[model samples]
Target: MADRVGEQLGNYRLVRLLGQGGFAEVYLGEHIYLGTAAAIKVLYAKLASDDFEHFRKEARTIARLVHPHIVRVLDYGIEGTTPFLVVDYAPNGTLRTRHPKGVPVPLPTVVSYVTQIAEALQYAHDQKVIHRDVKPENVLFGRRNEVLLSDFGIALVAMTSNYRSTQGMQDMAGTIAYMAPEQIQAQAETASDQYSLAVVTYELLSGARPFQGAFTEVAVKHTLVPPPSLREKLPMISADVEAVEMKALAKDPKQRFVDVQTFAAALEEASRNASSRTTFLGDIPVSQEQGASFSPETIVLSQQEAQEVSPTALFTTPDVAQQPSTDELLADKPATAAMITPAFEQKEAVEAVEAVNTPVLKEKETTALTSQPPHKGISRRAVLVGLAGAAIVGVVGGGIALLTHPLGSQTAIQPGNVPPGTNGGTLYTFRGHSGWVWSVGWSPNGARIASGSGDATAQVWDATSGGHLIVYSGHSDSVYGVAWSPDRKRVASGGFDKTVQIWDATFGDHYYTYHGHSGWVWAVAWSPGGKHVASAGQDTTVQVWDSANGRHANTYRGHSGFVHAVAWSPDGKRIASASSDGTVQVWDAVTGVRLYTYEPYFTDIWSVAWSPDGKRIASASDDKTVQVWDALDGSHLYIYTGHTDFVYAVAWSPDGKYIASAGDDKTVQVWSAIDGTLVYTYRGHTAGVRSVGWAPDGKRITSGSWDETVQVWKME
Candidate 1:
C-alpha cells in the first residue's frame, strides 16, 4: 500500500494510503482534472480475483443509496484486476478518530450524531440494503462536520448473492464488539444495523462500549449476554435515554426498534428534555420559592397580551375615573431588596425611579397602535402637571413611582418634536464615531445603546440622553458588530481583527479577547442566557464561546461562503447565521448541528435576526429585500421588498410586531413583521444606513450609518 502511494488508478492519483484492512486498502486520491479529493477503497488483488462480483455489488449498493447523511460513491472501476471504489472524501476523519476512547461527548452532540446516522441507516434500509458493518470507525465527518456513513463494502442487498459464505468462517464481517446477536449467527438484517448503532450511541454518551473484551469474548457476549445499562457507567445518562439504547440493543432482532428513525427520535427527545432541565436561565438568581411559583401559562398569556395590543396601547392614558392614585399604585408594587436603596439622592433617584418604572412591553403587543386623534379636552399643561405630581410623590415615597404612566410622561421628547438631523421623529443624534458606525444594539433595559465603528472602537451611549457612557477601544481594526449581554453588565464586540472582545459595559474594562476565528469576525451575538456568545466571520463558520472566560465551545461550519451575521434564538438553544453563500441557517447552539437553511435569496445574505418568540427569522440580503421565514422549517412567511438597494441590516421589534431594516438605500424602513406591510420609513442619514436596532422600550429604533451618526427616533 505504501509503495502505491503515487500510483494512478483510472482518473484518480493516489496521494497516500488512509487506512488498510484485511480485504482492502483505503487511499486518499485526487482527481486529475478537477483536483477534488476522494477516499478510494481498493480491494486486495487476491481478494478482487476471488470476489470480483461481490466487490462490484458493494459499489452498486452504495451508489444507489443516495442521501445527504450517506457518503456518495463517485466512481468505480477495475485497474489491472484490482477493483477500486471512489467515495466522497471526509477531511475531518472518522467518528473513531474524533472520539477515540470512550470520552463522553455533550448530550446534545451525542443525540445529534446518533439521529443523523440513524436517519442515514433508515434511508439505506428503505433501499433494502443492510449495512452489515455499523460502527464508529465507518462514520466519517466531512470538513464542515457533516456526518457521512461510509464503508458499505460489507453491506447486504436483499435477494443479492450471499458473500458471507464466500469469505468463510475465518473472516467474519463487521467489528466483533458492535455486531448484533443475530449478526453473529450470520443472519444480518436491518435490525442488526440498529443494534450496532445502539452500541455506538452508548459509547458516545458514556465514552465506553457496552461490552468489551477479546474478539472471541466480545462476540460471545453479543450473542448470549445482555448489554449493560448505560446509566450504570455514566449516572448522568437519563433513564429514558438508557431505555432507548437498551431497547435498540435487544438480543432478538424482532425485539429491537422497528426502524432506526424511531430509536433516534426517542434519543433526541430524551436529550432535549434533559437539556431543558439543565439549561442556564441567566444572571437573575431565582429563589426556590420564586422558581416554584413561575407559571409558564402566565408567561404565555403575558406574551399574547403583548402581541395583541398596539404599541400605542402600552402608552394609552387611562380614563381619569379609572386611574389609580400614585400612592395606591406604588403601595401595591412593593420594592424588592434588589431595588431598594438606603440613601436616595433626589436627582439620581428620580432617574432611577423612571428607569425602574418604565414598562418593557410584552412581545405580542409590539404592533403600531391604531392611530387616533389626540384627546382635545385635556391640555398638554394638565398632562405635565400630572407627571410632575407623580415625580414629587415618587421622591416623597423614596423613589417608587407608578409603573404604568401615560406615554407623554414616559418620553421626555414627543414624537412631533423632531430633533436636528433631518427627521420627523428624531429624538437624539449621537456623534462620536470618527468613521462609519457599522452596528448598533440596545441594552436589555433600553438604558444604553452600543455601536461598533470603523474607528476601531465600540461606544456605549445613554439611549435617551444620547450621552457617551463608555468607549471600548481595544480592537486594532474596524469593529463590525456589538451586542449587550443579557445582564447588561458586559458587551461583546467583533471586528476586522479576526477577534471577539468582551468588555465591561459601564467601565470600559476589557474582559477577554477570543481569537479562534481565522478570518475577520463580522458579527457577535450574546446568547439569551448571557453565558455564551455566537460569532460569525469570513471563515465560513459560526463559533459559540463562553462569554466569561472566552473558551471556545463549538464551531459550526456548514456555510460555503463568509458568514456575515449570527443571532441567538430567544431561548438560547438555537443560533441563526446569515452568509455570503446566500443562505440563512438555523442550528443548535450547543451541538453545532444544522436544523434548517433558508435560501430564498439568490445573492448574499448579510444579516439575520430571530423573532422575539424565536418562531421566525428575518434576513436582510444584497438582493434588495428583507425576508421573514419560519425558523424551524425555513418556510417563507413574508418578504419586504421596499428597499431599493442591498439591505444590510434587519431587526425584529422587541414586541414582535415589526421589523426594521436599513441598507444602501440611505433609509431605515419599519415594516409589519406579521404581513410585511410598510409601517414607516426614516430617511435621516445622508449616507447608507449600516445597522438598526429596536429600543427595549419598543417605542423607538436607533440606526447607525456610514454618515458617522447614530440616530434615535420613534415611529409616529
Candidate 2:
C-alpha cells in the first residue's frame, strides 16, 4: 500500500504513517468531527468483490471482543477493495518502547506484565478468539498506560482462513521468533497462544528468545529441540521458576500448560518462592553483561519448508485481482455499518476529545514488531499478596500448581496504637536497580534518598519524582549499606566489597575508601556532626573513621560474631551496634570502650535506631521482634511482636512518637513508640523488607526491599 496520508475514510483522516509492517501500513489518524486520534492500520490485500462481506464478517467477530487489555477495533471497512482497521492510539508506544529488546525487566514487573496479558488472553479465549500474532509489536499501550493487545485483525484471517493460500491453513501467520511449534504447522489454537506467551516470558527473563537463528533454523528448533535452560542465563533464577517456563515451552502443545493464565500464575508462584535477595535482580537475567538487541519482524513458511512471502502474497495470487495502481478516496457508504457493532462496547465519550491531549505519534518506521505488556488487573497489592498457603492454584480447571509456593496467606497486623495523623500509602518507587535494594536512607532535607543495591551500585534519587540524580558504581560487589551525611551533600556506602566508600551525593565523585573491614561491610551510619562515619561488617567489628580521610578513629570489637548494624545517638557521644552475637552493644564513640550490652533475648540483632530525643533505643531482631529499651540503663521497656519473620530494619519518627520496623515478612509496620502497638502495616513490597528510614519532615518513609525497589510512602 502506498502512503495514504490525506485520505479520508469514514470519520478519520490519515495524518502520518507510523510504521510499515509485512502485514499492514499503520498511520496516525485524526477524527474529522470528534478529533480523537487512532492508529489506522490499512492492510494491503486484494479482497475480491464477492469476498468483501466475508472480510467484514470476520472483522466484526474480532471487534466484538471489547476488553480493557485487547485493543479496540473502533471501526473497519474496505475502501475500493483495500481493507483498513482503526484502533486505539498508544502514545507511549509499546513495551518495546519502554524496555527495548534483550533488556532485563525486574522479576516482579515481569510477572505482573505477564499476568495482565494472560487475563486478556483468557477473556479472548472465552470468546473463541485466538490472536494469531501475539508478538511484542502487537502489544500496545493506551494513553493511560494500559496494555492494549493489538493486531487481532490477523486473527480474523487466521480463524476464517479467507486470506490463506491453496496450501490450506498451513500458511505461517506470525512473527517467527515467538511462534509455537503448532503455529509453524498452521494449526494455531488457543493453546498455541499460551506457548507463544511462554516464549515471550522466556525472552523477558533470560534476555533472549529460546530458539534463535534464521527463520528456517528457528522453525526447526521450535519443532524438535528443547529450549535452553533459563538458569543457564540467570543462575540466580530458582529451579521452580525454570521448570514452570520449561513446561510452558514444551515442544508439544499438549505438554504445555492448559492456558496462558496457568503458565503466568505458575511463574508468579515460582518467583515468590525464590529468594527476594536474589530475584531483586541486581544480577540481571542477561546471558552477557551488555546492552540490548532487536527481534525478527515477520516470517512465512509453506507446509514443508520456509520461504519468503510479500505482505500481499495471500491476496495478490492469481485467484485475486491486483489493487488499483493509485490510491482512491473512500466511498460515501462504509463497507461495514450498523450490522457490525462491537460485542461488549462501552464508549468512552470523554476519550473522544483527545486530539490535543496526547503528543502526535512520531513519524518513525521499524522492521521489527514492537512490544506492549498488559498493565491492568495486576496491582501492587496483587503483586505482593497471594493467600495460598500450600499452593497457588492457577485454575480450578486443568492447570499447573506449585506445592511449596511462596505466595500464601500473610499474617495480619493488629490496629496500631501510635499517634494518629499521617496518610500512609506508596507514593513513589525507585526502579533503577537490577537486583535487590538492600539499604536506603533519606536525605536531611527529605527531598532525596540514597540507596545501595546488589547491582554493586549506590544511587541518589529524588524521593517524590523517582528521578535519578547519581549512581555511584565504584563498589566491587553488592552494595549492602548506604547513608547520607547530615548536611545531605555526601554519602557513605559499604557492601560485600569489604570497604566503606565515601562519595559526593550530587555528582557521585569518590572521596575516600575505608579499607578496614576484612569481610563484607553490611551497615554504615554518619555521626550527628557529620565528621565521623561508623561502618559495621561481617568481620565482627564496628569501625569509626574520619569521613573526609581514609583514617580510622576507633575499632570496637565488642561482639563474638558479625556486626549487622550501627547507629549514632542524637548527641553523637555514643554509638550503638547490633550484631549476630545476639546483642545490641552501646559504647563510647571516641574510645573503643563498651559502655553496656543489651542481651535480654538470645536472638541475633539486625538493626539499631536511636530515638530522636536520644532518650531510648530500638533494635530489630532475628526472633521476629523489635525490642525497645532505655538508652541510659539498657533496661527492657517493651517488645513489638508484629512481624511473622526476622525483623531487619527499625527507625524512629522525627517526633519520637512512632517507630517503623521492616521484616522478612515483606511488610513495613509503624507502631507506637511509647507502648509498642501497631499503628499501620504497609504490605506493598513483593520481597523481604531490608532497610527503613523516616523523611526529615516526619510525614513520609522510605524502605528498601529484596524486590529491588526503594518505595517512598506518605504517612500523614
Candidate 3:
C-alpha cells in the first residue's frame, strides 16, 4: 500500500511509518480522542484478504495475552483493503536496533532480556499461543528500556494464512535462523518457542547465530546441527550457563527444557553462581555489523534434493549430531542476511525516530559533535507521538559512521549566543578519552569542563576551544563520576576503583582519597561552599567527607539499593540521592537523618537534580520520565515525557527555567522546569547519553556519552 501518513483507521490516526517488513508495516499511531500513542501494524491487503477473520481472532488472543513484558493489541480493523492491528507503542525501538548484529551486549543486560522475555513466553504458552517468530527485531524496548515481546501471534496468523492440515515440513513459517527444527517441519509447539528463545540467547551471548548461510542451509542446520559450545566462543560465560543454553537449543522438542521459564531460571542460577574468576564485561567492544537477518520468504528445495533428504539425511553434515564444524559457522561474518525482504528492516542502531523532532546537537566548529539539520525523509507526522528521539542517521547497511575526531578549527574563543530551537545546537566536542565518557561537569568559573571516562582517567579541558588541559589517571578502572570543586582549585573523581580521589585541578596531582564507601563509586558531587564532597555508588549509601582532608563527615544509609545519583540542595542543608530501590531519599546534609523518601516512581532512579531555588527536585528514572516534585514534602509536580527510553541524567539549567535530561535514547533534551514541555532536543551523541551538566553561565550544557565523547552545546 502507498503511504498513509495521516489516515484514520478505527480509533487511531496513522501518524508515520515506524518500521516495515516483508509481510507487514508498523506505523506510529495516535488515539483519535485520547491522544494515546500506539504501534499500528498494517498487513498487506493480499495477505490479509485470505484470513481476515482468523487474523481478527488471533488479534483477540494477542490482546488478551496481556503481561508486563508482552505487547497488548488494543484494536484491529480493515482499512480499505489493508488489515491493521493497533498494539502498545514502544517508542524505544527494537533490540536489533540496540544490540546491532556483531556486537556483544553487556551480559547483565542480556540476562535481563532473557528473564523478562521468558516470563512473557511462559505466559503466552500457558494460554496456548506459540509465537512463531522470536528474534531481536520482534523484541522491543518499552518506555524505560524494559524488554517487551512483540509480534506475538503475528507470524502464526500472517504466515499460516495458507495453513493446510496436509502441509507439514513443506509449509513451515518463521525467520529461519531462529526457527526451531519442529517449526521448520510445521510442528510448532510451546517447545518450539523455547528453542527459538535459546537461539536468541546464544546469539546474544556469542554475538553470532549458530546457523548461517542461505535459508535452506540454515533450516537444515536447525534439524541436524548441534550448536557450538557457548563457552568456547565466550569464555566469560560459565559452564553451567552454557549447559542451560545447550539444553534449550536441543534439536528435538522433547530434548529441550521443560519450559522457557525453567531454561531462564537455570541461566540465571548459572550467572549468579559465576566463579570468582569469571568476568562478564570482557572487552566492552563497540557495535559492529550483524549477520544475515531471517527473512519471511519461503525456502525452496529442488525436487531430487527434497526426496533424498529424508529424516535419515538430516545428520550427514558432520556426526549424526553435529551439523557442521564450529570453525566454519563461527567465523565472524554476514551470513547472506535477507536484507531485501526482511520481516522488518532493521536500522543500524535504535536511533529513535524523533517524535517531536528527536533533534540533534550541532558541533560548534571546534567540538567533537556538531549539530546538523534533520534528515530530509523523516516523517514530520512522527512528532504527533511523544515516545521517540529525533533521528540522527537513517538506515545504513555499513553501520553508523560516528564523528570522534576534532572537526573544526582548534582556536579557543568563548562562544557567546547561538539561537536555540527544539533541536539544540552543538558548540564543541572534547576528545581525548580512549573509552566511553561516563560523567561530565562544568567548572564553577565556567572556563573549563571536567570529564570522567572508562579509560580509567578523568580530564579537564577548555569548554569552548575543545583544547586538552588536565589529565588525572589515578583511577585503576573506568571512572564513572567526576566533579569540580566549588573553589575550582580541585576535582574529585571515582569509579571502579571504589575510592573517591581528590586531585589538584591544574597539575593533576592527587590530593587525599576518601575510602568511606566500600563499593565502586558511581557519582561524586561538591558542596556549594567548597568544604564538603558527596560520593555514592554500589555501596547503597551516600558518604560525605571534608574536601580539605579525607575525614568522613556523615554517611547516609537510607537507600536499600545502589545509589546512582546525588545532588545537594541549593541551601546546602539537604541532599537528595536517587537509588535502584525506586525512591529518591532526602536527608539532612550534616546529620544524615532522613527528611523525606520521595516515591514518585517504582523503578530505578538513574539521575536526580535540585532546582536552583532548592524548592523542587527533578529525577530521571527507568520509567522513561523526568519527574519534578516538591523537595520538602515530596509532593508530585510534573514529568517530562519526551524521551522513549531510560532517562539517565537530569540537570537543572543554571537560571532554573529549563531542565536538561539525557538517557539510553541517545538524545539530550531540554524542557521546561515548570510544566515539563520539551524546549529542545540535542541529538549530538551516537550512543546513550550518560551525564549532563549546565554551565555556570547558563549558556552552555555539557553531556557525556557511550560513544566515548563529551559534547558541549549552546543553550541559546
Candidate 4:
C-alpha cells in the first residue's frame, strides 16, 4: 500500500500515515475546507473491488449514527475504487496504551470507562448497526479517562432487508478474545456485539481475559466451561457490580442485557459503590517483584529499548514534559510529610479569623419538611415495603395450597408464620397429585395461581383464599407450561397435546385452541402488548399465534433439538427461545425469522426470559447455572451460580429489578437483576422445584415443586 498523505481527495488533505494493515491503512488527515483534523481509513487497493461494496455499506451505516462516545464518522467516498472512511481523531490514544500495566484499577474507574463504551454501543445498536469488534485496542481514552469506541469496520447492518452476506466467516468477524460463543460458532448477529462488550468489561475490571489460550482451547472454554465470577477474584467488589458483570456475560443472549444503555446504567450504579482491591485476576498471585521485571519480549514499550532513544526527545509533550512545579514536586516529599500536624492545627485558627471578619445574617428564612404518612399496604414499622399485595390460597382440585402473608410488621404475624429469611415456615403436603407438576405461575395481580401437571390437567386457584378456582381438564397428555396473559383476562397452557389451550381467566371455559407444533409444547409466553403469544416445543420450533384467534402467525425453525422455553421481549418486536441443542435463538416476533443464535453452553438450555425494558435476556441451563447476554449483539454478560442441580426455570420481575430461578436442587433463589447478587434463597421442598414466578407488583414469589405442593413466599 502507498501513503496518500499530502494528497487531496474530496476536500481533505492527508497529513501522515498512522497505521497500516493487510486490509486497510489509517492516516492523519485535515479537511482543506473545514480545516479540522480527522482520521481517514482507506481499504487496500489490491482487495478494493471485492470488499469495497461492503465497506461503503458499513460507512453509510455508521455515518448516520451520532454518539458522544463513538468515533464520529464524518464522510465516505471512493477514489478510483479505493474506498475510504473519515472518522473523528481523538487526541488521546487507544485505551490499550493508557491502561496501567500489571495493575487493576479501582472498580469505580473501570465501571466509568465501560459504562461510557456501553452507552455508545447502545446508540449504535438502536440505529440498527452492530459494532462487530469490541476490544480495548478499539477503544480510545479522552480527558479524565473518558472512553470512546472506535473502528466499526466490521459492523453489520441489522435492518430487515437483503443486505447481509451469506458468507459464514463474515458472521464470525470480531477479535477472538472478545467474541461471544455464538460468533465463534458462526452464528453472529447484533447480540454478538453485546457479548463482546461484556468480555471487554470483564477484562477492564479484572485485568485479565476470562478465557484465553490456544484458539481451540478458548473456543471450547467459552462453549463448555463456566466463567469465573468477578467477585471471586476481587473479594471487596460490591455485590451489585458483580451482578451487573455476571448478567452481561449470560450464555444465552436472551438472558443478557437487551441493549447497551441498560447494561451501562447498571454498571454505573455498581461502580459508584464499588470497593474491590484485588491486584491480579483469576488465581494469579501478585508479588512485589512482579512490577520490577519488565521483559522486552512480553511487554510492548516501543521507544525505550531502541538504542538511539533520547530522554529530551521522549519528553517532547508541552503539558507533561516540563519540570514539575515547586509545590507539586515538594508536596509529598518526606520533609513535608512531617509538617502535616502544624498545618492541621493552623486550619481552625485560619477559619476563626475568617469568621470574625464575616458578617452574620440579620434575618433568616426557615422551612421544615414534614414526614408523609406510610403507604396504604405498608406498615409504619416495616423495614421493607413491597411494590404490591401478597395473597395465599389452597386449591382442592389441583392438590395445591397457597399461603398469603401481608406486607407489614412481623409483630402481628401468626405463630407458625416466619418472617422473611427465616426457616420457620410450615411444610404442608398435598397428597392428591400422583405425577409431576411441570409448570406453575402466579397471576399478574397475585390473586390466582395456575398449574400444569403431568397428570394432563391444568388447574387454577384463588391464591389469597387457598381455595380451588377451577380445573380445565381437556389436554390428552401431560400439560407442560402455563402462563397468564398480561391483562389477567385469559390463561394459556401447552402440553403433549401439541396444542395450546386459552381459557377465560375467571372461569374454566375454553375460548381458543392453537394447534401447530409437531412435538410436545414445552413453554409459552405473552407479548408485552398482549396481542400475540409465543410457544416453543420438542419440535425444535417456535410459533407465534394471534391472541384473539387461534390463527398461526409464523413458525420459526432453527434449533437442532427440542425447544424448551420461549419468551417475548418487552417491546413485542423480538422473541427468544432456548433449546436442548445448547443454543438460544433470537427471532423477529412477527416474522419468525431467526435473527441471532447464541451457542455458549455445552449442554441444554432449559429456560429463557426477557427483561421488562426488552433490552436483555436471561437463560438457565443444564450446565447448572444461568448466563446473561447482550440482546443486541449476543455478547456474554456474566454467569450466575448457586444451584447445585440443573436450573429448570428463570423469571424476571415486572420492574426488571429481580430474577427468580428454580431448579432440581429443590430450592428457589432470588437475585438482584441489576447486578446478579443473591438476595434470598428458599429451601423447603423435599424434591425438585421446577418452576418459579413473581407477582406483578414484585413483592412476592411462588414456586411449584415435585414434592406435590406450591409454596408462596414474600420477597422483602
Candidate 5:
C-alpha cells in the first residue's frame, strides 16, 4: 500500500499512505501549488469498479450537503480503474481512540459522543444519504473535539437507485460490531444507520461490542440474540438511561430509534437526571475545509476567517486571496493535553528563573517575561534567547489550544440593532390594548397567544391564521401577567386589582378568580407538575395557590418592596422572585421560607425567571443589566450589560440556548445564557418593551411594549 502511494494518479500526486481500511486506502497529498495537506482514499484495486460510476455517485451524494458534521468532498474523479475520494483529514484521528485498551468510557462521555454522531447521521439521513457503513473508525475528531463523519465512498444515495428499499429486506454492509441486525440480513433503511449508532453508543458505555466473539458468531448473534442489559454490566447506570439504551439497541430496526435526531433527543432526556459529577462536553469541533487547491471553485472561508485574513502584494485582490490556503489555516492544531507532559529541562528552567529576578513589572506582563533586566543574574544573552523561545512557544501553543477547543462560540449581538428585518416598522400591531401590555405568552400548541394589558383584560388571539380568540374580562385594573398552562387547557391571569383569574385556554371563558394580594398583582405562574400555581404581587408577597380550587393555600412575604415576578423551579420544589428593591429572592414554595437573596448594589430588580432546568435564574433590573444568578445560593453567574436602559422583563429559552430580555430602551435582546454573548437585538418598538416571552416551540419570541403594539419576532 505504501509503495503504490506517492505515485501520480490522474491530476493528483499522493504524498504518503496515512491509513488503510477494509475497502480503501487513505493517502496524504498536496495539490501542486496550494501548499496544503489533504487525504485521498483510493478503493482497493480488486474492489475498484471497471467503470467510474461509484466515484460519481459518492461525489454527487457529498455535493448535496454543506453540514458542519459531514466530511466535505473537495473533488472527485476516476484515476485509472481505481475509484478515489478526497476528504478532510482530521488531525486528531478516529472515535476509536476514545476507547483505548478497549475500556468502556464514562457514561457522560458516551452520551456526548453518541449525541454528536447521531446528529451527523440525522443530517445525512435528512439529505437521504445512508452512510451504509457506520462504525467507530469512520467518525473522526478535529481540533476541538469536533466530530467529522468520513468515508462516504459507499454512501447509498436515494437518487435513482433501484436497490433502495421502503421496507426492510436484510443486507450486510457495515462493521459487525456496529452493524444493525437488519443490515446483517440485507434489509436497511435510514433506521439502519440509527441502529449502528446505538451499537457505537453501547460500545462507548460498556467498552465491548454487544455481540462479541468470532465474526460469524457476532453476525448470528445480532440476528437472533438480545444485547445484555447495560444496567447489569454497569450497576451505577440509571434505570432511565439503561432503558433508553435498550430501546436504541432493539434487534429490529423498527424497534430502534426512528431517526438519529430522535435518538439524540432521547439520549438527552434520559441523561437529564445527571448530577454535578457528570462532565459536560459541548459541540465537537466542526470546521469547513477546502482541498489543497486554493482556487475559487474549491474554497470557501467562513465569516470569521474572512475577517482574519489580510492582503499581500503576491495575492492582488482581497476577495480572491484573503482566505489562507488550507494548510496555513489548519497547521496550528496541537496535540491533546492528555498527550503532553508538564516538566521542563534544566537549561530552559534556568532562563525562566533568571527572568523572575528582573524589575518584576513591565507595562505589559505578557510580553515582559521575554528579556532580562540590566541587573539580572546569570548569562544575560542566553537567558534572553531561552525566554524569547519560550515566549514564542507559549503564543503558538495558545493558538493551537484554541483550534481544537470544543466549546462553541456564543452569538454576539450589537447593542440596539434590530435583528435583520425587525428593524424599520411594526410587522403587525394589535390595537386592542387600551393600556400597557404588561406581559405576553404564546399558547403551548402555538395556535393562539394571550396578553395581559393594563385595561384589566387578558386578550387572546390566533397566532397563525390570524384572528381574535376572546377577550377574557374579570380583573378591574391593570392586568400584570398572563400565562398558558402547560397542558394548554387553562390560562392564568394576574392583575393590579388584587385578583388572579383562571380561564378556559381555548374558549377564554372565565373559570374562577382567587383573591389574594393587598396591592397590585404582578405575576402568575403554573408549576411544572401542573397541579398548583404561584402568584407574586405589590403586596410584597408570594402566594401558592391550588389550581383545582380557587383557593390560596399559602402566602409568603419577604421582599421589602413589591414582588414583580414569580417562577416555579423545574422540580416544583422552589420559587424565585424579583423585587423592586434590587434583590432577587428564592423561596421554598411549600414551606414559605426564604432560601436566599441575590443582592447586587443599588440596582432595582424588574423581572426574574428560572431556567427550564431550574439551575439558574435570569433577573432583569433597573441597573440596565440582566444578571444570571445561581438558583440555589443566589451567587452571581453572569451580568449582561447590553441593555442601554432599564431591563423590564427576562425569559429563558425552552432549550436554554438563550435568555431574552426586554427593556425601557425599546429594544429586546437575545443572549446566550452560558456565556453572556448577545445573539441579536430587536428594536422596532417605539416605546419601552414591558415584557418578552419565548414561544412554546422556541422558533419565535413575542414582546409587549408601552408602544401599545405586540411584536412577534422570528428567531433564526
Candidate 6:
C-alpha cells in the first residue's frame, strides 16, 4: 500500500496510483513480460489478513462472467498476505469522471451507458452473481468508449465483512446516494442493483440525484419518501421516461421491474414515448465537396402556415402569367375539345370567360359564381359553359383558383376525383381491405403493391391500376409488415401471429412460414441477394433466416425493447433494425455481430430505411420527425419535420433523391433526401397513415392508412 509506482506487485509493474477506496487502492499497472496494461486493485494489508479468503472467492466468481459489457478479471493472488486483483484497464476513465456532478450528459449518452450497465448486470444475475453496489464510479469506459461494469461481486464481500467487524452497526460498502432502500436495510436483492442503476440514470439525465442531503438523511428518504419528479429539474424530460425512473426507485422492490433488463427496456421504451423537440444545428456538410451542405433546421409550420398554399407549396402548381391556348387544351383529348366548343358558344358565357381571361380574375367572379340572380332565365348549356370555363381558368392560372375559391372550401382534389397522371394528386386508391391497412411495400419491379391489413391478410395488387391480384390469408392476427424480394418473385409478411410467412409473389401461394419469434412480428425485410429474410418483433430480437426453407440462420438479441422495423443494406452485408428501445442498430448480416448503433435522442423508432446506395439511413419515430444519418459513423445528416404527428414509416426513394414518410398525421410527406426540403405532402387519407414506400422507379409513393385503404400517388 506504500507508494507502489515504479515497483512490481508480483509480475505486474505498478505504474501509478489510480485512486483509493475504503477497502482497496487501485493502480495502473503493466505486465512485465506481455507489456499489456491492467488495473490493479490492492487490498489494505490489515483488512486483507482478516478477509483474504472471502475476497479471493468473490474475485474468482466475478472472473468467470465473460461478457462484452462486464470488466474482465485477469490475475488475482496474494503477495505475502496482501491480496491484489488485476482487471481490464479502462483507459478513458470511469463514468463518474467523464460525467461529473452538475454536468448535463446528453440523453443519448445516458441511455447508451445505462443500457450497457443493465445488460452486464443481467448477465451477472443470470450467473447468480449480484453486483450489490451499482454506481457511476464503478462504470468505466474503455478506449472506444465502450461501457464496462467494474468491481462486480466485490461489494457484497466487503459489506459482509464490515457488518461482522462493526458488530451490526452501519455498513459503508456502496455509495450512499445510489444505495437502494433494501440495501440500506441490510436485505439487498437483485432489485437493489436495479434501484441503484435508476439513481445513476436519474443523475446522468437531470444532472442531480433524485435525493440529495446528509448521508443519513439520504438513506432515510430512499426508505420512506418518494423521489422528486424529474420534470421539476428537466422540463424537457418526457413524462414516460420520468415514470420509468420513478418506478425503478420504488421503495417496494415488488413494484419495480422483475429484472434489470426489464427495467432498462422500460427506460428505453419511455424515452421513445417522450415528447421530443429538436433545434436547428445549422447546416451540416454531407458530401466532401466544399459548400455542399444541407441545413438541419426543423421546418415546423404553424397550423395556418401549414394549411396555406404558399409559393413553396410542394404539390401546388406554380402561378402562371398566361392562359392556356385553345390548341393546348385540345391537344390532350378530342372528346374534351368537343365539350369545350359547346361550353363556350353562348355570348353570355363568352363574356364571362373573357372576364376571367384578364390579368387577374376579379373577386366579383367568386360572388357571381356563388350568387346567381333567381329571376334570370339561363339555359343549362350556358351554365355548363360557364362552369367549364371556370374550371379551365383555374387549371390554367393557379392564382385564378386561389382568388375565386371560397375560404375553407375543399379546393384540393377529393379522394374519388383523383385524375390519372395528376402531378400532385392521388393516382389510385385500393379499397378492398376489410380492416386497417397497417403496412405496404412495392414490388422490386414496381409492378405490384403488397399491403398488410388488420384483417389478418396481405393483399397483392397492380400498382398502377389498383386492381386486386391475390390475397394471402393465413395469419390469425393483424399483419404488420410486408416485403418483396429483390427478384420480385417472393413476398414476406410478418404479423401479430408471431410468424413470418413467405409466399410466391406471382401467385400468392405459401412457400414457407417462420415460427421462431415469441411475440408479435412487427417487421420483415428481404436481403439484397433474395436468399435471406430478416424479421423482428415484440420478442426483442431480430431473426435472420433462409427464405426458401425458413431455417433460422441467426438471431440478433441486442435490443431490449420491441423491434419494430428491419432493413437490409443494399449490398446484403448488414441489417438495420429500428426498435421501441429508441435505437437503430446496424449489424453484420452473416456474422450477426452488431456493427453500429444510432441513438438520436428520440423515443420509439417505428421504422428504418436504408438509402439506395447504403451510405445513409432514414428512421421514422414517435418523435414526429424523420431523421437521416450516416450509416457508417451514425452522424446525423438531416432531420425532416414535415409530419405533424408520430411518424410511423419512412422509405427512401430508389433513385436516392427523396424520402417518403407516413404517420399519425393523416398525411404522407415526400422530402428531398439531400437537403431535407419538403417536396410534397399527400393529404388524401382521412385517418392516420401507417406505412409508406416508394415505387422501384421512384416516380410514385404508396401509403396504407387506418382508413382501410392503400393509396398510391405520383411523387412529383
Q: Candidate 1: minimum summed lDDT over ten consecutive residues — where?
A: 391-400
Q: 1-716 in candidate 2: lDDT tens per residue?
A: 47789999878999999986655678999999999998898765657777777888988988898888888888988888777888878887877676776666778878887888888999999899777567677677788887777777755733332232211111221266687655554456788788878878877777777755323334544654445556666667676676677667665565567678877887887778775647456424355332222111111122121113221122111111222111121122233222211210001110111111111112110110011111112112222222111121121001112222232232232233233333348887888886567899889988889998866799999888999999899997778899989998899999876889989989999988889987678899999999999999767789998888968898998787668899999999999998866789999999878899999766567889999999999998867789999999899999999786668899999999999999766788898999987778887776668899999989988998866778998654
Measured over all alpha carbons after superposition, the RMSD of each candidate to the real structure, in angstroms, is 28.7, 26.4, 21.2, 24.6, 28.2, 26.6
Assess candidate 4 and give its TM-score to the true structure: 0.42
Residue 62, model 4: Cα distance from true site in angstroms: 65
lDDT of each: 0.67, 0.68, 0.68, 0.62, 0.62, 0.68
lDDT string, candidate 3, 296-349, tens digits: 111222224333432212111112122223233224434332221111111211
Model 4 residue 481 CA deviation (Å) reads 0.6
- What is the C-alpha lDDT profile of model 6 across 581-627, one tens digit per residue? 68999999999999889997446788899988999999988667888
Who wins the TM-score comparison? 3
Runs in model 6 lying further than 4 Å from the true structure: 1-424
Instruction: Show where candidate 1 strays beyond 4 Å.
Output: 1-422
Q: Candidate 5 overall Cα lDDT vs. reference? A: 0.62
- Report the lDDT tens digits of candidate 4 across residue range 20-106: 632357888899977999888775432235565665676677787777887888988778866677888877888777764344566
lDDT over C-alpha atoms for residue 301 of model 1: 15
The runs of at least 3 residues in candidate 2 whose Cα sits more than 4 Å from the true structure, single-residue gaps closed, are 1-424
TM-score of 5: 0.41
lDDT of 6: 0.68
Q: How does model 3 score by TM-score?
A: 0.47
